[model samples]
Target: MSHPPDIPETDAGPAATPESEESLEVLRDILFRHYRERIAELEAELKRLETRLTDPQILSAIIAPALGNAIRQKIRDAREEMIEALYPIIGQTVVRAVSEAIRDLARTLDAQMRTSFNPMRAVRRVQARVSGVSSAEMLLRESLPFEVEEVFLIHRETGLLLWHISRDPEESADSDLIGGMLTAIRDFAQEAFGRGEEGQLDEIQYGDRRILIEAAQHAYLAVVVDGIEPPGFRAEMRERIITVDHTHEETLREYDGDPTPLQPVEQPLRSLITSAQPQELSPTQKRLLAGFAAVVLLCAAAFCAGGSYLWQTVRRTPTPAPVVIVPTPT
Candidate 1:
């Protein structure tokens, strides 16, 4: 006999009776009735968002506020990457702008130097032109003599002393303290006066002494001088700071409290003092220099005299006579 066809079992967990299905439906309505309006609003919002994504104007209107903040946050997070990527676009432009700014600054300073400030200015200017000297150089020469009293290398962010050298024994203050003070003064000036400008405080003049600042990547230098800055003082300081910054880039970037590793930096700093136009000589030093010069002259004279005597001795020496050779018997 053929077996009866098996009936399909209920796969929806358990088969609900008509009354239980009606009870579940009633329970769902009771729970969702309060949220039906809010649900409809959300569905409409989602549909509108989908539409907005396809429409540029609508999307911009929606994203403008958060988009700006998001972009800024991204830029802050990946600054170096952003810079590298943007360099191709803004690099040359920024370079040209900087060059122009520097050129303009030079011209402005030149104009200031070229202007007549004294009664004898015209005469001196003419003389300067005649002597083939730049007015800036001439003015520098005429300016009161200056001496570099101190050189300080400091961390840009923390203002901690990296290295220090001083020629002024009287004002031998703590270098770390001075560096912090300088940083404070700079911050105050920039904030109170500059108001978040791109540039920085370059010089601070106090009576006869002046502070000159040169900035680098991770560090900055402060040069204290008495009297006036010479023509090349700024350039020299700039070059020196750049050299130090470049040479010790990694060390400077990772600088800790200890500065023993940067002892070699003092040698370049020493040049600033010695390379000044005028270095006063003590009487003892002058005498020593004179004696040294005298010794050099005496040595030159002796060398000449020795050469003449040798020539005479060679002339007077007799030559060896040639001897006849005897034929060998075969």
Candidate 2:
């Protein structure tokens, strides 16, 4: 029956909905773009790998190890040079991967070391600035018997050396030594901030020689004295010491109640302690101390033997009282 031509269903199915169609279109575009970018990146990587593989030396470096198994398998298969042909491919792959891994590792390590202060830029900054400069040339030479050899300034901010100035520009100092001195400055600064007592160390090793470093308010002065007489070194050091003293005096005098900018003090003897005691010990004093110690030990041993001995002897050894023990009359 030629029935009414089945009226085309006006109700568009779910697929015909505008929102559904739009979402589907968006999804398709995203997938297409993703695949295209992925393919491009993969192609680039492949091209780089191919170039690395083509080098004959890289091939040899890679495949020189799998010679036996490859040869044996190729022989059993009756191929003339199958192993030889396969070697290049295998070697190239291995070498490229290894090279990439090594390069990545090296980059990572370099970054880490920089962050951790491998070369210590703070200390280097101080060294580069003051090194080989003559801060007090004529004053250094005339005041002291020996030449004013070196001037090392430990940084107040970073605790790293700001610079090491040599009296003569001929001396070479190590960065490690500078770093160690910086550490010492930091430790001392923490310990001696406002206690009024400064710290000094005799015979601190610089590079190879021992230096008597005099720490000041914000800096330490170091002089090289290998075989030079202590008296001569001290004489030279005294001039620098006096210079530092006068400089500090002048600064304080100039400073009014107003807040003055804290200038970096180049006190060569900045670490000088007003309380440095001479270490020379007398033999007689030592002998007397020994005798006194012996007597003390004997007395201690006697007392320790029993409390009875201590009470009867050491404790009851009576002294003349202000009032004598008089007998009371009935």
Candidate 3:
């Protein structure tokens, strides 16, 4: 079959004319100007994301699980550097703990040794065994010679003197001030050394006199003594304090710095004075003394004849007459 005649090649539409080219260039410039700020914003956002991805925190979060072993090995290799960085912090913690522990241990051991091997305590124990009496009774008898010069019941928090009694009434004038000073000292110790509530001031000594302190939850007892305190004396004082607390629990719990609520404790304290007084010898000691006296009398009778000649010489001595003196005239 015959094909149709081929048409001559020609441009489909308008060719690249100068006016069209100029119009396209103007349009491109307008578009570029309009989107310039948005394109700049997108570029800035992309740069921020890139920087975040390179950060250690973000990078580690992304690859941590897969690179766990490698990361750990790297850390181990640089362990000396890590330790150097942390040395000051770790060293301070360990040193402080060790120092406090050693100080507490030394203080405890010193106090225990002092109480255990006291010479007066040893003597009292020997005396009790020889007399066939209880050590407590013997201690009380021995301590009776020493006086409880003063006693103070002080509030722990405010350092107020709750109650005070003194062997000499005139000495009670400064009891309140003394209690405040003791409290201040206790606070200073606790704050300076970072001691906890369990720490307390146990005693204050000046020359031959001392004030023994017994701390409780809300209050403390201070007893002034002129001589060595017997071993059982502190125990007795603790017992009395317990009794007082039990009897006055409610009043103490709601105490508002009032001294009146603790009045009842005074009677019990006075009873201590009576209990500490010296006692007479027991019947056992009296019978032993009487038997010794009878033996002495018999021995004296046996020696009477041997001393008769000496007695006769003493009786032969002459007696001199008394002389009267007359009053001289003025």
Candidate 4:
């Protein structure tokens, strides 16, 4: 009777009862009721994330930094592989940029050559040969005419920049630094070269650039010039500095760090930034041109005389009569 009644025991735990399932359902409903907005928000965020993941631009933005890092790391690991892959792209970019720059330079050269066909250029060519420099170098030098780039009014004693003006919109100069340097150089020159003499360094030149300094009692004006300065340019600089000093004598004497007090001087300083004047022919150049003109006139006179003589001879000579040739009967 005991063997017959023995049943199979399961390994599983006790099955869920109906009451427990009902209690669980009630708890789930309570959670949903309390956090309904939170659940909806999480669902919306998940949907938005999915949408963003499908978008190519957003995906690229998300992956760009990582992809770039990975690429850089790969390049670091295998430089040869990356170089071989991107060699053509880099090579082409470099070649294209270089070619464009060369083309621009060639166009500029061609324009200069075409425009520089004048008597002045011819005279300069002769002068260049006499100067023992190459004609190309001479032409290049002459092409860059004199121009005032910037002007700085500085306190003579303290070397503080008072008023500054520039012709070029792109000319960003440290006026104070330039003034200080000029002052230092002047001081050094006075001590080294002209200690006893009552003189100052008037000009500081480097290559085609010149710093023309005009000193006064309180302040000095420094003019930045490019290329060779024309005649009377120094006198103009002197006049500018003198005028500035005379106009603002009281203010300049009581010099301080503030440039606002000397703001009015900018107008006068601006006047110094004049356009480059056209170069006039030298005495020798004028003489050369005169001689050339005389030779050309003489050649013209000789040609006219020869043409008139030929015309007269042709008129005096007798004309040859036309002869009719009768063909023999074949």
Candidate 1 lDDT, tens digit per residue, 59-121? 888889998998799898999988888898798898999999878767766776777654344
Candidate number with the higher lDDT (1 or 4): 1
Question: Which pairs clash in the backbone of model 4?
Answer: none
lDDT for 318 (candidate 2):
73
Which candidate comes out best when scored by lDDT?
1
Model 2: per-residue lDDT, tens digit, 64-138? Answer: 768777778778896757768788998999999999987876675556445753223333334445665342332
lDDT, residue 91, model 2: 94
Q: What shift in Å separates residue 105 of candidate 4 from its native position after superposition?
A: 3.5
- Give the range where candidate 1 is weakest over 10 consecutive residues by summed lDDT: 117-126
- lDDT of the candidates, in the order given: 0.84, 0.55, 0.76, 0.83
Question: Which regions of candidate 2 deviate over 4 angstroms?
Answer: 1-149, 155-163, 167-171, 174-199, 206-208, 230-232, 245-330
TM-score on alpha carbons, each prediction: 0.43, 0.25, 0.43, 0.43
Task: Give stretches of model 3 more than 4 Å off.
Answer: 1-127, 130-145, 194-197, 274-276, 280-330
Error of 1 at 127 (Å): 14
The 10-residue segment with the lowest total lDDT in model 3 = 136-145
Model 4 Cα lDDT, one tens digit per residue, 1-330: 355767889899899999999999999988787598888999999999998899999989999999999999999999999999999999999999999987876676668788845777787788889989888887666555688888888888887778778876576677678778888888889899996788888888898788888898888888888878755778888888888789888888886677777777776677667535446688987897989989999999999999999999999999999999999998
lDDT of 3 by residue, 120-199 (tens): 45555667899798866664444344667888887776788888888778746688798898889878877887555556
How many collisions per candidate? Answer: 0, 10, 0, 0
Off by over 4 Å in 4: 1-54, 67-91, 112-117, 129-177, 181-278, 318-330
